[model samples]
Target: MKAELDLARAFALEEDGVTAIEYGLLAGLIAISIIAGATAIGGGLNQFFTGVGNWFSGITVP
Candidate 1:
């Protein structure tokens, strides 16, 4: 009975699971921020490239 009680106490005091969960959440947030930033940058780049292509297409070459 004493050993069982000690084991229960050890389990209760352990923080490994909580720490892992916190790290997982942090990683998820970082990934979300990276994706959002990439998406915004990609849209801007696409527009800039499209404009450049349109300008090039307007040029008349002999």
Candidate 2:
């Protein structure tokens, strides 16, 4: 009974699991932010390139 109580107390005091979960959540959020930023930048670059291409296509050379 004493050993069981000690084991229960140790389990209750453990923080490693909680710390690992917190780190995992933080990493997931960082990854999501990076993906969102990259997507936005990629869309803007595509539009800019398309506009430049259209503008160049309108020019004629003798």
Candidate 3:
């Protein structure tokens, strides 16, 4: 019974579990920001390349 009580006390005072959860949340936020920035940049690049292609197509090679 004494050992069980000590074990329970140790678990209650531990901070590693809470720290891991905080790190997980931080990592998730970082990943979300990266995904959003990449999506915006990808759309802009696609539009820029399409415009360049259209301009090239309008040229006469004569």
Minimum summed lDDT over a 10-residue window in model 2 is located at 53-62
- List, residue by residue over 1-62, the lDDT tens digit for candidate 2: 99999999999999999999999999999999999999999999999999999999999998
Clash number for model 2?
0
Tens-digit lDDT string for candidate 1 (1-62): 99999999999999999999999999999999999999999999999999999999999999
Positional deviation of residue 49's Cα in model 2 after best superposition, in angstroms: 0.5
> Relative to the unseen true structure, what is the Cα RMSD of model 3?
1.6
Candidate 1 overall Cα lDDT vs. reference?
Answer: 1.00
lDDT of 3 by residue, 1-62 (tens): 99999999999999999999999999999999999999999999999999999999999999
Candidate no. 1 TM-score: 0.89
Model 3, runs deviating above 4 Å: 1-6
Provide the lDDT at 60 for model 2. Answer: 100
Measured over all alpha carbons after superposition, the RMSD of each candidate to the real structure, in angstroms, is: 1.0, 1.1, 1.6
lDDT for every model?
A: 1.00, 1.00, 0.99
Whole-model lDDT, model 2: 1.00
